[model samples]
Target: MADKRTTTPAGPSTSLQRGKACLRCRKRKMRCDGVKPACQQCTKAKKGDACEYDDGKGKTRTQLMREQIARLEARVKELEKSSSSSSHGSPPANLSLSASASPTPFPLDMDSSPWDSQWNGIPDFPAVNGITDSYATEDPPIELAQMLLEIFLPHRHQVGLEVHVGRLRDSLHLPLGEQRHPVLMNSIYLWACYLSRPGSLCEHEPLYLSRALAAVNDAVPNPSKVIDFIQASCLLSMYFLSNGRLLEGSYHASAAASLAIQWGLHQLGSTDLTVGVIPCDRESTFRLNPAKDAIEQGERVLAFWQVFNLDRCWSVALRRPATIPDSKHPWTSVITPWPQRMEDYETGELEINSGSPTIQAFFVHQAQVSPVVGGFSTFAHRVKASALFEGASRLSSSWYPRLSSSPSFTENFRAFEHTITRFTTTLLPLHQLAATLPDEKTSLLLIHSLAHASMIHLHQPFLEDQGSRETAVRAARSLAVVAKHISDTDYDYLDPFIGHCWVLGSEILASEIAQLQAAWSPHPASSELRVELNTLLFSLTKVAAKFPLFGYQATKVQKLLDAI
Candidate 1:
């Protein structure tokens, strides 16, 4: 067939031979069928344009990458030097005045600022040198701020401390010289320190807390700064509670509630035409438009709930009555819509309606009918559960002394029980699902644990009746199981509020075990109860290893167990 095998090309051999592969193929460690314009591998990858060969006169690809990296390193050094030089310049004198006049003034850029040094591990904070005045006008060290935020942000939503993440991040980018709310900054730092690696960051807790406390103390009297004051107060309250400083926490919690009422946040959605108008003044205008942006409005809604949550939670944690009574004047008069996820407000999915039904409306409506699906937030569920638990605590405390003499006690008790049952039925499927994201899981566990705890509190006094005692025991045992599961799987990720729930649930479990031991005749359930209590205690100790407050409480439980 025309000499069958075609004559071989004269100049170059047709047989493929390994030559210098294209740079792309060499880098990828793939064999290249060295074609002139483009290698077969590159062509097949659709990266023909990227197929480059070493010209034999230039550096290799590895050398080129090294040179480029060196250039980038040099550029970074130059920028750092420039930033260091610029930060020494005096800041604008009107910065403080502008901050005061503008409800939400944008801060100066952090680059080319003294605070930039903090990010590079340089000590830029004046407080680092023991100068306090510099702190009043400067930002906290950026490194410290970042570390604290990293520790706190993940836990914030779970604890009902949802600050506007976008706004907070924006504020952090401001130059140290720019004026910002000290209370907010300090409160954030304080909590960050409290939640940081226990021994490493704990020392900063008192310093930041003192600053936050001082700022809030001064801001609370100024009507123009009421919003800042309330926010700081809420943060501090939670900080104190997490550290087991109940009295101080309660004080700040009560103060936040007072501020909420004083600033009329509770009435933001009120449509009562009978409400009288105050004279229009600068302060009044500020109060009316404090939430000038969507972020601030979302913050206001969240702040109110934070205060409400604290009031409800601590009432049971401290064995005290809830300060905010349901259906009471200001409590029921709140006109602000129930808080939504921060993302919803940030993305404009949720619009702030001027006359939306208040959170109180949902509670009132829920009391008379079935809970509306998606009517509230996971936070609202926690608040509702806490309120129910508080009611149970109140009933138990007041009625325990004269259970038989209180003729109406049984009816009131039944009503409370019915309310709890109704509320449980309204929980979102996500809240009850076994598998969820870490944050959702923590919320779910807390809500269910609190509900079970409320049941135990409501029925423990009625333990004289066989049915009531079994119900109480069952609830307590369920709570122990839940606690054990959470500690087993989510101990490291649990919120600060979880520690409070753990304490409550563990105590009940421990009490039940103690009672079982004290029985004249060993009950068939004793061994099972003992096993559950041991598992729960083991989980609590694991949790305590992380949180000192839980550690303290866990130790107390351990002692009780030993005695039993």
Candidate 2:
């Protein structure tokens, strides 16, 4: 009693009170607590759910753990059984594979290593067999299909769309192979063809379409495999439908939906495959009538475009070096500069990643005109053009100044001039190609993009420059033609595109009139001309303000109106 005065009873062990014992230990699995969430005994013993207290109340924690362990063991057994049956039923036609084995790399590069590497977030095509149906060869399509499997799936590597197309074209010409792995083969064929179609500049060939379809038809032999395969098939078809191939694309996509239900795959890969299908009823020359598939495809594609635009712009911002002001100390930390060569140039080659083939052609042509700076500036303009269609409101006074040029205003003007010319010349033709296609939705999308591009060009600051009045006027006149296109289109089904363009058109008109008025000289009827222009600008401003995206544009115009 005399010695105990210095110390009180020790507190309960904090760890034991906090419920930190491993599940197996709690469940009386006859193993140490290990006190880990994932105990070695549970993991190594494959008793995943065997962790709880052994206190017996006929319904204690250990009893629940035992039940859970039984269930998990049952599930593991089922999966093992299914996998073993599938493997035994049909071995791979060309190359045998197991999930545990190291995969062979398929060689399928389109041009070179750079193309084979990641661009933006997309991985380069794998080194798979490059043979296509169009290639001068007579090998049975199975060989090419085998090549595709090796490139895309046998190794499960991410590949670009182009490589898939090359293998598909090869497979298409060859005779059909045995239905050993129909679902997988069907998937490959369908996706490759879908991705091969020219849509936008960013539109490179799709590498998996044909393989997916071929896998379904000849890759997986069991109709039961359809349940497993249908989701991927639908994905490839959706990719096609989204890229302006609605008619034929819808057929495969619909088939996928039916098969998904038939094979009971809806639960396993619901959104992974069928999340995009919607309900609608509209006949079109280009795309299918609005049904679950079309609706799903439309929404998904629109979402993709939105994110794609945001990413391109964000990438530009990330690439630009931090231009610290001179007000800071001269003894700044050393920072390495980005590589400047297009070959050496990262943003130096292409700033806006549209992923459209048509745009790439423009890049190639401009490269010849002025290989380094000129080409870079021209591409920079293309990126700016995207601003018109991209922002929440097309007409908003967003600064899409040339990215590759010097920060000086004079440099911006020069870049703007080159970009305008390139935009006018190429953009129109690209839209024209869309018009020729039967799909109204695709055509409208193309037209909208073209209109936005023109509008951005018209709104560049040169319109207010006295020395550039003539050039500004020319661009304005060209823009008027695009405006007429926007005005003429029936925007009933195209509220998104129309709203974007209408705001842009208003911005262009207002800016142009403001430039002309600013350049006005003291002439006899100057007051009357000014008043007339003001009225027109006011009307445009009212229209622009009504749109959500262009409300900012409208507000700016109203302020300008007040000042005038």
Candidate 3:
């Protein structure tokens, strides 16, 4: 009999219909169910939001790849236009940088040629450089520039950048030829070298450094944007400090503050402070058109705090008067509110003129106050710590009247002790630091370290007293813990002020070690003390090797120990 059964049609088509897969599935070379909104695999993976599909135009994989490439190229050109072009636009919401609040170790294999490294992302263009006269140098290619800039963005805070990063990134996308002013870019490139592992990138630092200084000088006479000067000066100052160039570093730091003061950044959002004497505008003061939006206003806010931090911390480091005045004079008084993050400005959370006094409140024995009710807690705490550092530095000087322990001095000293106690023991205590978010670790580390260092400085001049010695010892132990924490990590960038603290810290520990050695019998805690001392010295040596600013002090401590 003839077979009536019909053979089943081929089980399924051998080929996939083009454009049938979700984008993520296509990238992963997985089968797609073609579900709307999300595919079954993506939904199961909980990546529904990331799942996407092209229109069913039957485009090939190569065509989709080409489209993505074209889109990326457009973004680069757009950034190039922003970097050097005259037109200013409101920047996008976020940047490509990862963990900007505190940077983690970048995964790049620094020992390899940077050319071999993959393009991580675009620059967020934080204004962060140096000098007079143009130093001609071969410019890096676009690919290399992107890589180096990507390296700089996440660590912008480490370089003291105080600009609106999104806006700055918008400004940074211009092409190399259009970059008539490369001051900020070159400065970033130089630091990219400094921050990278010892490798080919490090070799180009001088070239970038020279060009950065030249760029600064070239721009000084006719800057397209004045804020770049202030931001560039900050990085230059930090760069010099790292290289152990004290005078140059101080000069740049003062210049940054002076420029900020002249720009009226110190008095942003207010002009009504009453003074006994009338004020007159100076020719050097550069005024800007009213900010078009909140981001520009926020940049102005950050510029002031950037200078304030440099002035306060460097003054303590140098044991000299800070250049940025904090007096009651109409022209010189700093009335700007404590800085809020760029987001606060973007979200309309800040009340500009409502902030009464920042440093003024600190002078009256109150913590510095920010306009935003609860702004970046880390920044506020750091600002308070900076004030404490400045006060402690002043009191440690032999000529400071506070050294005499007069009734007024005693009162002020006790007040400082109380504030420092609260800072280290209550608000943002060190023991709880490990629980902080990853992005906040470095800043919190700096805050606790600075607080304890302030305690050491406050008690150092009176170490002759048993009470003072005990207090200083206690603070030194805390500093050791912080240093040990730092040693455990691989952070390539740190503020110059931290190095200054390490110098003082190493000195105190060295002194204690010597005293113990001189005793006929070993102290019961001798082994533990040696371990702490070794840890501090090890960290100090590591830092000094990388940053020369602390080398002289580290050498002194090592020599002192050798003699003991």
Candidate 4:
């Protein structure tokens, strides 16, 4: 596969003399034009050095840090073994990314676990015929598709922020009853699930999960609604199951599965097209069904929850020495153990409402705030002038290189540029809103959103830039302060996940910044920052792994003792 590269400008001419060297020139250890994007010298060489991105080996923080640490440890072992000839020692184990303990040891085995029943154990959805045709027209409605383009076409970074923050509970001031927006409700549940801290299943699960489920129930009956409700229920059930609420959690999970099956069956026969109001021509240029997407997405969620529960159950079963021999207990002797599935954890690609006419309205409604636009409906229409922000640039032009050959690319790109200008220019107000939020939960929500966004942007395949790294680092610093305060207050639940997320995010961005540091020949002070960042990553990793709820305190203390 061709490697994705961020677009940079062409190089300058050899005739153009300048002080600052172009990146191409510098990489080749030659002269630079200092002209933005491209320089004349590199362009003249036909080097096509327009790709200014440093892939940086694309190594994740965990992978890079582990390799570095392993090398250091090997050196230490070599020295120690040479000094003491008559000693045998085992290598140290790698540290886990769970929680740590304080002076007292953390009890890791207090929670009960139950094995989740498979689909056959519960009621299964009866198979349906003629279902293939339903999935054939998997496009968004023309208007909604256009709207999605408009709202998301410009200021994609801001749009990403809206999508993510809208997922957390604190972002919306609407009461539980009033917070009926599908995007907001679904996002919050996912955020809570992603943000679970050590031992947080006791409190945080109930608060957010209950509220989210309520909002899901309040939404219009649709496939998306069923998926959201079922997914949230599964998360809550998993939390409850971990906390030893077997009967209650099992009942809830079972109910959720039943509902999901019904919805899945319904989706096979129906079309989803209700999020928009305006009618388009009968010709189906674009048609989208969020509920149908939800049905498939729900299955993935269900499988994940099942695996999590099954793993917990197996762990519980293995807590004590097994008396049964492999021959006697064949089920227990299954060869392959369940490892965490990475794909299930990241839902960035799910197209819940693709190409739907209502999606344009959705973005307009999302970007709407009181006084900034008239009423909610009016707010959506006003943004409609820009096609709700969708333009050509937001579309992955490179995915279909043929797009550039068509004149529409130029039109869409220009429109997208305008949309970007409008959205980016107004984001300061959103930042202001975040700055003024007094409620700790709300504040944490804002900070968490910012932190997640910064990290995501920094890691984006095609969009990783200095601005994204800077944004991530700054957000992490600010969020750390707020998280500290929240931890000290009644809103302690906000602290645990916030710290973990911030540390992980900061480490990733900081590592990338280190690469950029090489190009700028940054000052000694900046070098010091980079050094301290290494220490920060280690300390934060230790602290996050020791968190009381999810921290696996017993194992951590054991590792700490070994270190000492």
Best by TM-score: 3
Rank by TM-score, highest first: 3, 1, 4, 2
Worst 10 residues of 3 by lDDT: 96-105
* lDDT score, candidate 3, position 38: 78
Tell how far residue 348 is off in model 3, in angstroms: 2.6
User: In candidate 2, what are the lDDT values of residues 1-564, reduced to their tens digit?
Assistant: 756855767765544432344534543434454544446657665444333332222364323433543443344345445544767864322222233321112212213321122224322323234323221122224444443333232111111111222233354455444232344454553333222222110111222333444445542345423323444544444343233232333444445434433322211111223322211133322221221332223222322222222223222222221121111221221111111212222122222212222223332344334332232322223333443233212222333456324456445444544544654554434334322211223233334443443434444434455555445344334434433343212221122223333333444445555555667734444454345434434433433332222334345545655654
Model 1 residue 292 distance off true place after TM-score fit, in angstroms: 2.5
Per-model TM-score versus the true fold? 0.68, 0.28, 0.70, 0.30
Candidate 2 local Cα displacement, residue 562, angstroms: 7.4
Candidate 3 lDDT over residue span 30-109, tens digit each:
88887867789899876674566655455533344335444444554465456434335533211212222212112222
Model 4 weakest lDDT span, ten residues long: 332-341
The lDDT for every candidate, in the order shown, is: 0.59, 0.34, 0.63, 0.34
Error of 3 at 127 (Å): 24
Per-residue lDDT tens digits of candidate 4, residues 294-323? 324333333323322322222222221112
Backbone clash numbers for all candidates listed: 1, 77, 10, 44
Report how far residue 362 has shifted in candidate 2, in Å. 5.1
Candidate 4 backbone clash number = 44
Error of 1 at 339 (Å): 1.9
**Whose lDDT is higher: candidate 1's or candidate 2's?**
1
